[model samples]
Structure formats: structure tokens, C-alpha cells
Target: MSLRIFEQRYTRMVKEACGSESGFVICMLNSQGNKDLNEHIYPIGTYVNVVDFNLLDDGLLGVTVEGVRCVRITNIKTEADGLRIGDCEMTAPWEFTATKELLYPMDKKLEEIFKRYPEVNSLYETTNFDDPIWVINRWLELLPVDAEKKQEFLQENDCSKIVQYLSGLVE
Candidate 1:
């Protein structure tokens, strides 16, 4: 996934992460920053691997990061430079099975849709349509669902449900 950090305050941290062997951490806060720091100090986040980065003329540092896994922050402390550091524990990754019986028709349907809408094909240039997980995840991304609904589906972790949902959407 791509992460765009536009704030000027994070430029140094982003540059340092790009240079380091260990990449960066991405957190999802349950609430806005108005909460007491001690009340919700340690938030869960994703540990990511930086694939590549570029400095843009607009002063925005563009970085491409692939999520490694989910991590829960057990403890957090911020440095003097305003960088937040955390001690985290890796959470169990999502589990799913991609049966060929489930994937065959899905792949065919996706191909048909792509043919009808050639403009969107570029998004899947490096994706493997034959892989059921990839197909489902890509469909989830392309679907016109709201963010909250998409997040719910992602957290569900049931591939069959996702496949069924997409199949219905395709219909």
C-alpha cells in the first residue's frame, strides 16, 4: 500500500526511515489526538517495509511502504525530535484459503470486467489475477464502498464472505 505523508513536520522522520534498514511504523488511532496521552498512549499499528521513496519539489516526501504485519504497541515514548517510538508485539496475521473452485469464475469475471473497462487495467499490471486473495483484495479496493464498510470487511478476515460479497457486486 502507498502512504502519503504531507505534513512538513514528518519530513525528517520519513527521510531517516528511508535510510534505515528497519523501515517505519504506521498507527491507526481510535480517536483524534485530543484524548489524554496516558489514556490511549499505546495504539496498534502496522509495521511496514519501505520499498522506495522520492523527494518531491512540492516539499512532500513520497514513500511507498508495504505492510509487513499488524503490531500492537505495548509501550510508547516520544523523542525530543517529536518522533514517537514504540515497543510492539506482532499480532497474528489474517488466515484464509483460496480454493481453485472459488477462484476460477472470479478470475474469469474479473477479466471480463477489465475488458469492458480498459481504463482500470493499469492498476493490476503487477497483480496476479489467478491468485484468489489478490483478486479479492483488488476487488475490495476497486469497489465503490465507503471507508468504514471497507474497514469492516477487511477486519472480517473471511475470504468466503469477501468472495460472496464481490460476486454479488459483480452481478
Candidate 2:
């Protein structure tokens, strides 16, 4: 459970990635309902591996994906059918280290969230509450902030800023 970016062939892309045991990068749309998808999508994305996939009750595919790392997208091309393809370069995962005491509130709040909403809980096959990086990553995904603001975080080499940012919200 990491980022989920919507696309024209969203389900198809998931299936292709899952069937082939390949990973995919997810980026955000700059604006909604834009016909020019390649131009509209932001450059930063999260590279994730498909953890699980199943045929949903609605007959659509249900997929569980976990973020492996970050990436920067370039040279995007949209096919006639509207599938946007791009060249991606690996970006460093935000780096930070903190003691369990510092991350306790975030970990506990996330635990409460999972307990309160089974649907959200069901998304992850496993959770690492004791790991600060794991907690920080989940907070980034769950935050309701604007995508533009969240995008600013990708540029930060020190993830301690993220830890501070999230602590302010969680506390």
C-alpha cells in the first residue's frame, strides 16, 4: 500500500504489471479531466510492486501494491489509446532515522486508523509499525494535503523534515 495514480487503462495496467510480475510507477495528474494525459501528469512518481491481485466482486481487478522506491519521469508519450508511457529514473527514498519513542504517536494513530477501517487495513498484507520509515511512508500516502505540496517533499534529501511535518499533524 502506497500511491495509486488513476489512468485511462488503470485496470489493464495493473493486470499487465501483475501478470508479468513487473512493477509500475504511479504519478499524479496535474488537473482532472485533461485530454492530454502525458502532459498533464506530474514528473515525480513512486515505483511499487504488486503485492496481491484478485478479481473483485464488481468484476474489476483488486490489487495490493507496495512502494519500492521513488522515481522521476521523463519523455512521456501517450499512445493512441491513451496509455501514457515514460522513461523513469530511480530516485532516492527519503532518508531519516528516529527512535521508536519519537514515532510512537504516528504508529499508534495509524494503528487506530487501521482498526477503525477494515477496508484500509485490508489494503496491506503486512504492516511494520516499529519501523519509522514505514510509518512515515504510510503517513505520506494517507495525508489529505494537496498533491503540489506533497510533491515538494520529494525534493527533500532529509526525511527528517517529513518526520517533523507528520508529527505536527499526528500530535
Candidate 3:
């Protein structure tokens, strides 16, 4: 299915498919094509869940969705809890499938980065973070975005790039 990138209008009652109670503010997008033609304009009060996340080029984020078919988002307005898409205001809950191969290397990379940057060791260890992807995203925010360094980071399926990037930072 073809991936469609649309500006999220914001969702209400955002929860993970695993059944989380409290909602989180998240933007949802889909990788597979929407065959139903749900229209592209989103109204307010749209509920949604994040099925998958992938880092895109030029600092864009990629998300894949599973449920709540036919999302049409025209313009999005930011609100206190979520954004209002057109006038719909809907909530969409979704599920994500995580693979071991994808996660294991990310953990390994973060650990290796910590070893190199001992100064940030505590930062790495003490935090009760959700997963290695969070750490990697954080690191990406602070570290310099050198092409060679970024290439080095993207070279491996794991965190070898993290070490390479961290070492560059310390140097």
C-alpha cells in the first residue's frame, strides 16, 4: 500500500491499542493506502492511535496506522489537549506491532553510546524511559547533524551510529 503523509488535525481520547487509560497527544499517519476514500479534510474531535513510527528525511516523522479508516485532513488547528481538524473532532485508537530485530539493535546502540559518553551515563541509566527509540530521538535532537555522522548513524541496523555520533560530540 502507498504511504500518505497528511497534516494531523489532532485526536481526542488517544490511547494505545494495549488499552491505556490516560490519553497522549500524538499525530497519526499511515503507510498503507486508504482505499475507502475517507476524504482528506479532518474535522475536530478525531481520535487516533499511533501504529508505527519511522524517522523521515528532513526532520519529518513517518507513522503507520491500523484502525480508523479513511482519514481526510484538510487543515489542522492546535488546541490544549489535541488539534482540531476542520470541525470533525474525532478520536482514533490504534495498535502497533514491534519486531524484536528492530528493537534489539536500538537498545544495543544506546548502551554503546553510553559507554563512549560516560559523562551522560547517569542520564542514560536513571531515566525510566519507555524504549531505546526515545533515547535515540533525544540524542538526535542535541547532537550535531553532520552528513557523514548521520550517514554513520544510519549505516547499521543498531546503535553503532549512536556511538559514532556520541564520540564525535565528545571530540
Candidate 4:
């Protein structure tokens, strides 16, 4: 599976396009060109959507944005890019940790997950990876998806929506 990196603002479009039922939201570092070398650069602090993500495993989202790449991951408590959740209309020099799951994709991991969290469906009912439903479902698990939550996702701007959805899950 090709990793599809996107802005948190585009959650609605990504969800609509991928039809994912759940997953964590990510912000890519816009590292296409060196716009300002003097500025502090961290891999996960980027608010602008542009960065390359390292998808080390197959069937996992390894996509990253193009320019000045950084990720405002929602799982951490750092105040990178204003508040972690809400409309992303501000800028900042901040930091947050990437989720262990985002760093690790599962095939074998699925077996471990099934063994551990039997209550949760880590794998879907269908194995059709290409199907939009299946594809989105995988994304949903990765990004944290739910109906009422996704509706909130559909109504917000990209950046804050990711933070909101992720923050909601942690809460």
C-alpha cells in the first residue's frame, strides 16, 4: 500500500477519498526546498503539509508531504503548532513524539495485536486491500476512526481536525 500523506485540514477529503473508518491523523514536513535555513527544523514540528514519511513496511501508510517535512503528531502532549487540537491557524517551534504503531506496521504485528487486544478488530472482516471500504478501515484503525468522531473530522480544517480526533481518542 502506498503511504498517503496529507494535511490535517484535508481529513474530509482523505476520508472521502479513502473511505477510512479510523486511523490517527498526521502532518507532513514541507521539505521540498530549503526556504529558510535559519529556522529551527524538527521532523515532527512542521505545520505545513510537506514531508516524506518512511514507510518501512508493506501495506502501511508511508506517504509523507514534499517540502520542509515535519509531523505534528496528535498522540503526544507537546504544544507544537498552537494547541494540539482545534483549527490550525497558528505557527510555532514545538515538538511531539510519533506513535509507536505509526513507526511499526503490522502483518506479523496483527497476530500480536489479535493476541493482545481480542476485543478490538485489528484486522477487518474482508481481506480485499484494494476495496475502498477495506482500505479506509485499515486507515481508521491507524488514525483512530468512529462515526460521531469522523463527523467532527468532516467539519473541521485539516490541521486541527487531526489533533482533535487524536486528542479525543487519548482522552
Each prediction's whole-model lDDT (CA): 0.66, 0.78, 0.42, 0.37
Which runs in model 2 stand beyond 4 Å of their true positions? 1-20, 32-37, 98-100
- Spell out the clash pairs found in candidate 1: none
- Tens-digit lDDT track for model 3 on 67-122? 23222234455455444333333323222134434445445666677778777664
lDDT of 2: 0.78
Measured against the true structure, the TM-scores of the candidates, in listed sequence, are: 0.64, 0.78, 0.25, 0.19
Clashes of each: 0, 0, 25, 36
Q: Where is the poorest 10-residue window by lDDT in model 3?
A: 38-47
Per-residue error for 132 in candidate 3, Å, reads 4.0
Worst 10 residues of 2 by lDDT: 1-10
Q: Write the per-residue lDDT of candidate 4 for residues 34-133, one digit (tens) a residue.
A: 4243122222332333233454545344544322222333323324322233223233322323333331233334445545875545233334432332
Question: Cα RMSD (Å) per model?
Answer: 4.2, 3.5, 14.4, 16.9
Which scores greater on lDDT, model 2 or model 3? 2
